[model samples]
Target: MTFTRFVLSKRETTLTVVAGLLTLLGLAVVYSFPTWGGLGGMALFAAAIAVGGFPVARHAFRELWLSRSLGINTLMVVAVVGAAIIGEWAEAAIVVVLFSLGEALEEYSAERVHGALEGLLDLAPPVALEILPTGESRETPVERLAVGDRVLVRPGDRVSVDGVVRAGQSAVDQAPITGESIPVEKKPGDEVFAGTINTSGALEVEVTRLAADNTLSRMVVLVQEAQLRQAPVQRFIDRFARVYTPAVTGAAALVAVVPPLLFGQPFWGEQGWLMRALQMLVIACPCALVISTPVSLVSAMTNAASRGVLIKGGRYLEALSRVRAFAFDKTGTLTEGRPVVTDVVDVCTCGECPEDCGLQHAASVEAQSSHPLARALLAEAEARGIAVPGAQDVTLLSGRGIKGTVNGANVTIASHAHFDEYVPHEPSVCRQADELAAQGKTVILVQHDDEVCALFGVADTPRASSRQALAALRARGIHTVMLTGDSPTVAEEIGRHVGIDEVRARLLPEEKVSAVAALAEEYQIVAMVGDGVNDAPALAQADVGIAMGGAGSAQAMETADVVLMSDDLAQLPFIVQLSRQARRTVTVNIAFALGAKVVVFALVAAGLATLWMAIVADVGATLAVIVNGMRLRR
Candidate 1:
């Protein structure tokens, strides 16, 4: 890389190098008194102070002027100036140099934490092959490609736009965007995101979003925003530091003056009270304590982002660690949102229905509707290779079912309630429907005029990982509850299947919010998990809102505090585990930093700590906390 790029990217490292070299140069001049005289040594020390102390003094004065408060930098500046006034030029130069180096290392540690997520910016290709109207392709910048433009992705190439596959087939590796290890099979009409690799076969994708608004770009933006937001612990430390710095400065002042004036103690010697005060000031910097919480939070957030979980801020991550209850939406959370036809019971005795069964007629009428149950019927019919003759004059029965003319006969598909209340149906068929409903299946009756033809049992099944994830949460002593709009029977069945501790059924969007609020009151900290849009109110009401299938929906990413990019319930357990670990790391870091400072302060009081020892204690604590925080990156 060029020098400019290196300096821009590794600014903290560069600062440390410059400050260290200047300090060493000053030390060499002072020690080599034979070649360079005492005057020359003094000049070198002054130069070192001028260069290394400039930034320290500048920052100190800037903060003093703008915030009307004294900071750690001000304490360092005062200590250095006092040492210089006492004719300790070498010590003053070394002190400033060490402070500068410590600050740079702290900044460098923070940069590394952010780098884990910022590296995602490079995953997407800058340009894409845009297919033109004349069946030709041109290399165009992704930014120039608008929505609805078709792009051709060749084999082994990364997809450059968030689009739908218009044609062709491929297994796209979505690890960069969704954290899915296995390559996802993509065919026509399936969504493909930017930064995903087309592993096999070529694909023609129709752009759904511009490059700037794509999933990868949005994730980077969110991660950056998350880094800027401080957790409660970090804010508390900041407040403590603001008060602690000035209080320590005052105490240092008393140690310097009160002892010599009242007790006739020496004030200028190597063991003077003034020197002890300087050591106290150096130990009082609080650099490590102020840095402890934020570094841990940033590292934890970055790690989460890398694993396909987007934590909005440190506040939410910290909140997650303490969550006692997790309220989950059943439809698209614990259970697959996509319902499928599971059972087909033929109840027709008239023998006037379709030869293959009434599935063809049901599919024919359902093809005109866009409901999820309609898709289930159509998918089943397509799977069975049953030809739909197509219905005409299709009329939606308004919250009941659909009615249409099929094969010169009136065919009506209705819900179980509608079937029993209006249409004449067999009691055995009704009993069969009850059995299916008891098993969490939604039964839709297919009728031929006045006679019931077939009972279709449609169900949205639980995700394969749902049981394991809930069990994991329960094992962690967290209460799991299912809050859904499905019927009591359906909700209870799904809750049992997923091993949820509680179940609330037949709830509207507003009711879900109330349920979450009640959970929060009982459990203290409750997390609501949903699809991010339909359950947005409940998600907002909870302490932490987690959205599933975030990679496919922008609403999910925007509505939830935490988003699992892939539709994986298993990530919930992983998030909880990571949050707890992050919390522990933060606690350990704070305790270590404060304990180090306290030990040094006691030593300073006992007249055992020197200027060099004080600087080492401060710098060493900062480094210790930084290393501990960075461990979460793994």
Candidate 2:
């Protein structure tokens, strides 16, 4: 900043500068004996006090008279008045200046974290290119955009609203929301969030949310709310200060009067106890104790947010530090949740047929169905270069199977339930299906008339990082459990693949909640990670609820105590490590602040600590606390 700008910048700076000048002029003139003598020195010191101490004294008076409060400001005012009574004008001036400087430093450290939050506001573009019905585009403020409006986002532009891509193909960087290092591919019907950059293609997006109602806006609101929450240690310090200040005041009063009266000592003598009382007041200031833990927590939260993990508040962060067990929902949390056909086995016992004949018949009928397993069958057939013959007179069998005529012969593709319910199959065929189901595959049988033709095996694939994350948590001695609605066989298969320590299968939503409560009872703190609406109850039941891929599910994001934006399991360990480190930092800071105060207060009571030593101990401890808290930012 320039000299002119610095002078005009902040009220604190302006006041500090003026008061600093007054103190320097008074000190210089008072020490130099060639000036207008002691009378001139006293007047200059009084002028310096008026200039430097007005704000502090006014605040102290207002708080005491209006709120009946005994704050640190009140302590400082009392000390300054006691110094003036002892004719220690230079000490009074120094106290006022140093107190102001210490407060400014504390404020600067606090604003540093708040400034990181303000950076979120700059991620979104102020204007958006609206697509008009007349086949033209107009630049419009994002605030004017409503739901269902169409907007054009060119390559390298930030998406201004949460919406669906109507037309486009490109990799959009979602690091701002999900913390994923890689850009995600966006195509027609894919969802996009606000503030993500469109990297390589122009997109026509139909906005599904208003400008103010997007995910980014809600996150900002959440972050602001988190900052306002106080940690347990911070609340303890606040309660301590409310009592400590008034107790210190009474002690200082007793030190100033009782000792002098009982010992028959003069009140204004060079050896008077007034100076000792003033030193105690300065040393007992709770500035360091009150600011330590909160600053550390705020810095930790801001740092976590920057890294793509959202910790709801200090309470959750504290609980996360103690988490000894982690429960994860199976689908979408540990696996891809998309079923794919893995194998096709021919078991036809009827008349001889072509090698891929059954698959060809299954694909022909599945191509017309919209079920997830049907799509998987069609995709597999397409990949195998098979031609699907047209089907006629298709009949939907609800949850059983589909029946249709492919080239004059009837083909039925059905689940095991269908055969068990209607057309009972041979023991060998049923045994083969059971064997496939035992291996966690969804078995679908294709029947040609009364004979089984082919069997298709499908399963949800586990993510590439699932095993590594589970192992990392296990290495940290954290118990890992999987909760899923799948059958016991299927859940066991998936849990073993991810190396989970425990697996609970066939769980209903209420059962999942009971499992979470059971874990909580076994372990003091447990965290649950899930992505679907069904996981909401269990999430709320856990000590800390973490949602995976929160970018897609608003309910998951809202319900979970912590949301991993990237939907990646790797971030889970990183979050736990960071939270543990933050908790350690807060502990160290509190220890340092209290330890320093105890040593200084003892010296003051023994009459060995000087006024200069008291000031250094108070202000220096505060600066150290601020610096220690800021280390989490890195």
Residue pairs that clash (backbone atoms under 3 angstroms), model 2:
178-565
Model 2 C-alpha lDDT per residue in residues 97-214, reported as the tens digit of each score? 8887787778778777887877776788888999999979999999999899999999999998899999988899998888888899999999998889999999999999887878
**Which parts of model 1 have CA positions greater than 4 angstroms off?**
1-19, 25-40, 346-356, 391-412, 420-426, 447-453
Decoy 2 TM-score against native: 0.92
Where does the lowest 10-residue lDDT sum fall in candidate 2?
Answer: 1-10
Candidate 2: regions farther than 4 A off = 1-8, 31-45, 264-271, 346-360, 382-390, 407-409, 417-435, 448-453
Question: Tens digits of per-residue lDDT for model 1 on 1-634?
Answer: 3334544566454554565676687677667766655667667667777777887888899989998999988999999888888877778878887887788778777667666676887788999999999999999999999989999999999999999999999999999888888999999999999988999999999999988899998998998898788888888998899899889999999999999999999898568999889989999899999888988888888888888999999999999999999999998889888999999988889765656468888998989999999999999998999998879989998878998989887889999978766687778998999999889888999988778888999999999999999999999999999998888998998888889999999998899999999988899999999999888899999999999998999999998999999998888888899999999999999999989988988988888888878998999999999889889888
Q: How accurate locally, in lDDT, is each candidate?
A: 0.88, 0.85
Which candidate ranks first by lDDT, i.e. highest?
1
The alpha-carbon deviation from the true structure for residue 178 of candidate 2, after best TM-score superposition, in angstroms, is 0.8
